[model samples]
Target: MILEVAILDVKPDLTEDFESTFKAASKIIASISGYISHDLHRCLETKNRYILLVRWQKLEDHTIGFRQSPEYQEWRSLLHHFYDSFPTVEHYESIILP
Candidate 1:
């Protein structure tokens, strides 16, 4: 599995609007192939800050399947405007321990 993480810093005054829009955008992402699950978390220390975590079956599931799909355009339209700056997204794999 792959984990995609992004730190979103929304406009302070538009946090409420951003959250509402995210709710709608969530459906678009969830519909993509290989989308396992996702979560959005708000920061207590910074009200406008948020973290988006998504689980995918593979890296291409997001980079190619989702980002290259039409649904991504809708996702971008619904939520991109709220970001103060473009967020940096990273992918990770779990480390199994003995």
Candidate 2:
């Protein structure tokens, strides 16, 4: 499985709006192929900062399947404006331990 992470820095005074939009946008992402689950977390120290964690079956499930789909436009429209700067997203794979 792949874990996608993004640190979102929302514009000043827009955290409430951003969170609400994210709630609506969640449905869009949840319907995509290979999507397992996701969480959006707010920072206590930095009120406008948030962390988005998404679990997917594979990397391409997000990079291609979601990003390239029309649904992405909806997601973008709903949430992109709230960003202070574009968030950098990265994916990871779990490491097994003995």
* Tens-place lDDT digits, model 2, residues 1-98: 99999999999799988888899999999999999999999999999999999999999999999999999999999999999999989999999945
Which stretches in model 1 have alpha-carbon errors above 4 Å? none
- lDDT measured at residue 13 in model 2 versus the true structure, 0 to 100: 92
The per-prediction CA RMSD against the true structure, in angstroms, equals 1.1, 1.2
Q: Per-residue lDDT of 1-98 in model 1, one digit per residue for the tens?
A: 99999999999999999999899899999999999999999999999999999999999999999999999998998998999999989999999945
**Model 1 error, position 77 (Å):** 0.6
Error of 1 at 43 (Å): 0.4
Per-model TM against the reference? 0.97, 0.96
Can you tell me which runs of candidate 2 are displaced by over 4 Å? none
